[model samples]
Target: MTRPFPDDDSATLAAHLRRQAEEHRAKYVRAQSDRADKFVTSPRRVYELIRAGIRRGTMPHDQTLSEQHLIESLGATRNAVRKALQMLAEDGVLVRARRAGTSVVHDIVAVHDGEVGPRAWAGTPDEGRLTVDTLEISRISAPAVLQRLLGADTDSVLLLEQLGRMGGQPLYLRVGYCMTDATAEEFSQLIESNHTEFPPISVVHERLFGSAYGGSDYVVEAISCQERAAELLDMPVGAPVLLRELITRNSAGAPSELSYTHFRADRVAIVGSTLATTAASP
Candidate 1:
């Protein structure tokens, strides 16, 4: 709303009046949103909008979510928007608290392209509580890729399967195959003795070999979830998934471990960034 300026020759007075007007307008908006019984939007519709924003990477990833902004943008009642926020929190897409407000869980599994090794992507980058559960650790007959990458003499590789969860919701499943001289039982014993929960793969490598990895290479692709992975991730078979293939090398530049990570495509988004490049001269 616009109002005619007062007959005052002072610009300071005009600024003060504008500040007061803005404060009043904000309060009015909040008051209007508090009337939950009169809005046209339903709670489910508000949730869909929020879900779409998360899936499309349009929501703010680093900032606290604003209840007032959602209510105003969606023309939704306070209760409807509130329920939507709660739903996202339940789904592990957002973290909410009475005093902390709501915020998006931006990257449940995020890492930069240039980071060196499992040291780069092994740790967590999410906002909510995260847990890694060990599913299986066994010896598998070496696949053609592993044999070619590691060496022809590698007859069997150790398989380390894990499930990743955020806020109690399953988000990813990782199947890592390491070309190690140790047997499956020996590796399991080492993992148990090393840390309490499922430790990082690099830690296991260090525990077993007593050396740090040299570096790692990563390749990301889109794929359909197969039966075994779908069952663990709580998604339907044939659903979209993001596959991240990582190959960790020894200090001598020899490939040591090959890992495949599958993330729910709907809950994960990969952003590409270049830090070592510069713009052309003007």
Candidate 2:
């Protein structure tokens, strides 16, 4: 039964109907585009995308992740979503409780093969803000292992300990052994400034020599925490962690600095890549 409206009322009703129709059409078009985008991606790409998100700090620590949300936002299939979640869980980046669903315990790390300078890839703008707090800086005898690596007397190396936080949450514990002639006092300003790669090892190199480091070699593996690391990282002793042992090389290809960084397995994600030289995004 259609009740005839006054002329003015009819005009308003028609305009409202038109707006509703346009909105519906726009929503359908957007859904179709999202579907198309999802259909063209591979399973591997889905895994990488999830990893990329974690690296970009979008998947925050301890945040419950919804499978349906991931599927919808990523335009991925059910199987693809399940597979990605399983892989992440196995990688220690996520955990699934009995009814709580999957939750993030990982953050992203970009592994470009050089100093912490301009690199092949930059993360999306949402990447976590890392604040480094220098705990102790002392001119101490090098650890036995570092003494052998440095091939110099133990008395010369400077020890710098730091703790990294992302948005006030603990991220990593770093112990840097700098093979520089700079005094412990000289490194205070640099390390506290939180620049120069969590420790000013490179700055000392540049201040003494005229150029930057040649490169760095990283040996990464899964390890169980020891006393010091367990205490600072707030993890149980023998808890599994991702250990990155880095040796920074001078331009002459000689190792001048060494650092042991223990990253929280469930609170950090490491994404490594090689890039060809090209103009970066504007």
Candidate 3:
């Protein structure tokens, strides 16, 4: 067989393809980080500027900003602005009424969960302060929903209701349930000591179980606040609120605690992350 000359054009084409792929990957990572930064930082500034514009009559209340308008106003990309607007809406900073587009309403409350310690408050320990007022802990029979979360029979559960605050403002109203025997003694002691502010139940779980507590497998959904919950949160009855229901398990995978939290729409922001999944190879 005759030897064939190597195809120089094919080699060049392969190298070009590799370069293009690298450039595309770099661009994707930069875009993703840029969008995340917008969500983390720029939304607040955007809200401030928009609010100022509205107050100065530069932006009317009835004026609607499409996604493009927001991008232009903030000098951000369309994707970044869209992500910011979604975060704002979830946090109740902006109202997106049906057929009304998006408009600035009130400032959204920033609520940080202390699952990984209290580093969430702008790198200041003081900012992580949880001001406890209006704290009234009362024992009651666990409701059906709470009982299910606790993985216990209704009769075996006791609910502890607490109205919590941060910086003297009511931020979340929570109801926690535990097996009556598991928490009765501590509950009695807490009441006797007149402890107004208790550590998070996760901490309590660790102290009681002698093992560190991991976070719960939980579900978060937005629901209309009940009349009682709404009153405690200072919102109108049936107002929209974020409801988080957590079912905590111990190292043995046994349900240890069930917590139901209703956050004030204006006073709390729930931050979460999404994972990127890769496809399986054939």
lDDT of 1: 0.72
- Among the numbered candidates, top TM-score falls to 2
Among these predictions, the greatest lDDT belongs to: 1
Model 2 alpha-carbon drift over 4 Å, by segment:
1-49, 56-66, 69-106, 114-128, 143-145, 151-155, 194-211, 275-282
lDDT of each: 0.72, 0.71, 0.62
Candidate 1 Cα outliers beyond 4 Å, as residue runs: 1-128, 143-145, 193-204, 270-273, 277-282
In candidate 2, list every pair of residues with a backbone clash: 55-108, 105-266, 105-267, 107-268, 107-269
Worst 10 residues of 2 by lDDT: 113-122
Among residues 3 or more apart in sequence or in different chains, the pairs in candidate 3 whose N, CA or C atoms overlap within 3 Å are 111-269
User: What overall lDDT, based on C-alpha atoms, would model 2 receive against the true structure?
Assistant: 0.71
User: What's the lDDT for residue 138 in model 3?
Assistant: 48
TM agreement with the true structure for every prediction: 0.55, 0.60, 0.52
Using alpha carbons, what is the TM-score of model 1? Answer: 0.55
lDDT value, residue 118 of candidate 2: 16
lDDT of 3 by residue, 150-190 (tens): 76666656566777665555667877665546566666564
Q: What is the number of backbone collisions in each predicted candidate, taken in the order shown?
A: 0, 5, 1
